[model samples]
Target: MHARDSLDPSRSIWHFIAVHLRRYREAHGMSGQALGDVLDCDRSTVSRYESATLRLKRAHAEIIDRLWATNDMFTNLVDFADRADEGDWLLSLAEFERRATRIRMSDTSVIPGLLQTPDYARATLMAGTADDPNSALERRMSRKAAVFDKENPPRLTAFLGWAVLGQLVGTREVMRDQLAHLIELSELPQVSLRVVEKEAGAHPGLDGPFMILTVDDRDVAYTEAASRGRFLMDPFDIQEVAVRYDLISDIAAPVGPSRALLRAELEKYS
Candidate 1:
């Protein structure tokens, strides 16, 4: 790590964890690849975590604690870091997502990030970030667990614009795989997937994609643009977004038909 990078921990909570992670790993004379082997991940993943490009998951932190004999220190720090991370918009979204009991979203440009496959996410993230696309891709993929948690998964309803099916992201094969994954996810009882037809034309969703995350019976609205993201906290703002979601949802094809639509599109790619 560069000297300036090493000294940046005081500016961000994740940097503090990163600095210590590198310190303890090196103190034990362990290479990044060696540490990753113990963690059942790759060297790049370990490097991203140490650089704060990727958030350290709680389970990973616990394993590190045991490996380094840190006595739950890393565990406590992971918890704090999750709550304290405010430097990255997506990171904050991941934090709130894990706590949400319900999620409703509408996407016009592409598949929502939470529901994206690795290849799909990589393609989309690569178009956005010039610095480290792979790290951003991994960070986005890590957040999917919020929707897939078997013990207490959030109820997710996603409305995708019909154009999303036709848009070419990475490759024909990538979209084929992603559409297949969507079919499987739609089968889950807690997930409701729908598509707004191109014919639906100029709906409220044309403005942009937005998400409503429900936590403790309260809803928070999140909107993402090319350059930045906004988290709407005012009750009125959240309610308005919720209302728009309902308007869009009403026009979307229900899950059964949506799966058929996905399979139909899958054939084109195949």
Candidate 2:
């Protein structure tokens, strides 16, 4: 199917701008190549924008606004759409975590957000966001903080891949404090912390990290990638994540040994 014909604009936040761009372009009797010439891009980029598959950068949006004589309407809408899409996703995930009765997670690179100390969180956010790190840090930390303050917080079982324990994030002191925090949380009644050693060999979890959230009796799976988070609601997909979690957890060090391992790592930091 042609990308343009298959687009369902109603499902896209940028669809409003896309519709307007196409309408204005057609009304002006301009071809996609003609519009691309003004924007310094190609026809494919123009088609992608009109199909809602790609969003325009501010500089490109500026050129479009001037060419189409739409004043700042296109640029304003683009900005609003970008922020709304990002904010809504983050808000929904935070709400999901709050309502979950249980959260099972696997981390292959670094400590899970819920287990990170403020220093570790701040340092990690700085490395990731680069721009406006403080704002991002505050928002993420707030979500984690609120989740734990609930009167009946979710039961959390975190499976830390072997490499996660050895990965260095932030300063040694910050890492020491972070590991100390993990050890303390491991002792909690509702939290289970396990260390999956590399000796376990390859497993399904090697695919990527994922979380299974249990709300009421339903299970939802969440995975994050660069600049986006995906939620899997299909029972089959959710079940697969649950099975992966179980397999990874099976090879993880038990609570007693996990605590000892953490303490040994902490000693090195000291």
Candidate 3:
């Protein structure tokens, strides 16, 4: 079956835009190549956009609006989507993480998922909502293998807030094991793990936790919140998150010192 045949418009704003845009084009008896001509791209790109595999940019929406005299509906849809939060971001996250060449992350609340140990992940999962925490734990644990065990794993640069070392997810043993695991991951050539000391004293890094992923030569970002995280696709949004990661990385301890810090914290738990 074709990708668009199974497309669900209600899945996300991106899907909504793609589904409707294709709808409008088909209703007017327009072909993908013709639409691609108006959008100044090749047919495959138009195909991806129409299948909701790629985001439909606001600029493209405006061009379509002008050509079809749709009263800026697509442009307006893009605007609404800009302000909206994408709660269903995990599928996209996994898809992009698999294709990523680089990943930069800054976490203020908990250990970043990719670096988290099983006990630590279990603790965090138990604290949150999960229909089956055990199943969730297994899935959570698989994320590390999924990303790192790939033939060419993405290079990872991670900044963990100092408080995270002492955050106390499960037990002293669990925390200690988690720190030890981090120390090990720090030794990997592909992973550069750092610690961001609290004394850095109030920068935009305090804004929250986020990760920027570089996939297929393009940048995308994910910003987490108390409830749900949002995927950022727009160039400006990606830039802002990149700046946040950079700011935090600047104050973050170097990898060697960060590993030393982890060891020091581990001694405390010992």
Identify the candidate with maximal lDDT.
3
Tens digits of lDDT, candidate 1, 1-270 = 232263357655676788889899999999999999999998977876776545577899999999988999989998986565344566557766876789999998999988899999988888775478877777777788755864889999999999998999998999999999999899988999998987787899888989998854557788988766777755678889989998997788888888999999999987
Model 3, 163-191: lDDT tens digits are 88888898999998999999999999999
| TM-score to true structure, per model | 0.68, 0.67, 0.78
Better of 2 and 3 by TM-score: 3
> What is candidate 2's lDDT per residue for 135-239, written digit by digit as tens?
888878888977788898889999888788788888998999999999999988999898887788887777787788775445778887667676675567778
| Window of ten residues with lowest summed lDDT in model 1 | 1-10
Please identify model 3 stretches exceeding 4 Å from their true place.
1-37, 40-54, 58-87
The residue pairs in collision within model 3 are none
Off by over 4 Å in 2: 1-87
- Candidates in order have lDDT scores of 0.82, 0.79, 0.83
Per-residue error (Å), model 2, residue 194: 0.2
The most accurate candidate by TM-score is 3
- Rank by TM-score, descending? 3, 1, 2
